[model samples]
Target: MAARLPPGNQRHDGEYEDLLSLWSDLESALSVVLSAPLRVQDFPAKVRQVDRWLQDLVAHDIDAALYLMFQLASTSSVGYSASHALVCGTLCHIMAQELQLPPRERDSLVRAALTMNIAMTALQDVLAGQREKPTAAQQDAIRNHPQESQALLERLFITDNLWLDVVGQHHASISDRVPLASQEPHDRLTRILGTIDRYAAMISPRKSRAGRSATDSVRAIVGHEVDQRDEVSYTLVRSVGLCPPGTFVRLDNGDTAIVLRRGEKANQPLVASLLDRAGAHHARPGIYQTGMTNKPRIQSALARSAVAVALNHRTMVRLGVYAAAPHNSGLMGLVTVPGAL
Candidate 1:
């Protein structure tokens, strides 16, 4: 079980509080939809609510929001589908902002990313725990999930063409076989979603495989033939930085730390020190600004297997690694409070 946040009066910026609350609401909404037997009638409303929050974050505190969402990817005990949706939505929003996409287009992408896997929510959760390759039945479901998700959305009254189109084509690949001239704007959106989806999934751990290292995942995405020309790929790599949040790294000073946020430089990111030079876990991890010359610099991104220590979300929050963000101060406390998870 996850640890509870210690009781205290924590101060945070209002924007951070709002974003945390919105994130909680989204989790609750998704939990209900995924666990219940009937389709959630208010699913569209929930998507809109999350869309508004994403728009707000993009407009005001995007970096903090991205960090929070990435942290949630590990901290969230919710099944894979909910966590993946949140991560994908956050990444889509960040990439869209980097691309300077118009507000309407950005929101549509966010919405599409959030709901693209709705049809296979339960199956995704099941797959996360299975070590073998998917069965033929599961394979068929995976192949048709995009269209099924779109149909479900239509039944729920989602009328935006952009939202519908992006959701439907989310799994579609851009092929050398298909002429680029035939691609539409929605296809571009699909490419963005696909790139982010695969990248996020690769970095996330599952029963079948340990998650890829941050640097390795970036290299894979950048090296992909289909994604080589996709600007979204570059934007994702830049926005998340070389050491994205939640990634573990070894420092030049012989300490191990988990990245907390991106810094001005791609390789220099904010991090929370976990192990000291002697390789002992600290009682309380210290947040460091790797961009500062006096601070220890990152030597390399560490693979998951290389780090033997087990760090949980509650511990990360209690250590204040994520607390530096103006809006994030009180969130960790709130998220770990009794029953909050």
Candidate 2:
């Protein structure tokens, strides 16, 4: 049965719609190799299945696309680099779609996403047990996988070297001096995709300090040359609720919401109400727009339990008082924010 979201969930419609689409596509693609051994030789064929899905994303609501992509890539499990590429590519497509870029640019974003994590599969096996502690080199390798993915893509035959080159240099800081050995062509859309591709990976939940809020993530991205920071920033901000993506937050108005939707216009995100401190849903699954409350709004996107336990975190720092633990784990499915947040 198609999973139905309860009413009162502000983002339930949009998020759930996107999720259903993504699940249908992912299931169809992964099913081909579900029984096959997990190996690189079989990756291309499997990825080809995902190609139709990427092509389908060409016209989707970009915000939903990005949110869905982030959900797929930034999980604790399924840390394979290949998975990263798929997710990242999906994100790039969302960015392109949002900007209404040309077909070539959209295609480039998909190609780049598919290749960015080429090296990740090699290291994905290592991620299984290192959820808590990772070695310096492991972390470094993970960070540099873009380059590693490029090299691997070089060995594999691809019609366009442009994507591999972009994937290789995707992580290259705008200030990096080494003339990247890249010659693949690109248009404005392609460049934007490349930029978003890198940004998505950077601000992902586990990639950095888990506490980094979406706003900070946007500021960090502004350092790069991507245009219209306001749009991307707001999209990320509004997509998730008062709680930033990856971080858990409780709102005032006596409600506990998770950051699942980003808005390019406001400060608050489209939050999905999970529980109240007393363990009830005072508010429905919807957006809690965080505005200039005449109080100190807890803006930090920190780990939930840690902050709650260590600091004795109370209910909605900005609103009134309503706090609880997260419950619903279903994909937000890229639901739209109901202007309220």
Question: lDDT tens digits, residues 137-170, model 1?
Answer: 9999999999998988888788989999989889
lDDT of 2 by residue, 1-341 (tens): 11334445446355434554665466345433322324446565555557666656534434344444544444433444444556556655555555565676556557666656556654654564345567888889888887876776666655556666677766554422222123234433334455555555554445323423444445576653323334543343343332443344555644455554443334455444545556544323443534534532334443343322211011111111111114544333222232222
> Per-residue lDDT for 19 in model 1?
57
Q: How accurate locally is residue 290 in candidate 2, as Cα lDDT from 0 to 100?
A: 49
- TM-score (all chains, Cα) for each model: 0.79, 0.58
Q: What is the C-alpha lDDT of each candidate?
A: 0.72, 0.47
* Winner by TM-score: 1
| Number of the top lDDT candidate | 1
The count of backbone overlaps in candidate 1 is 1
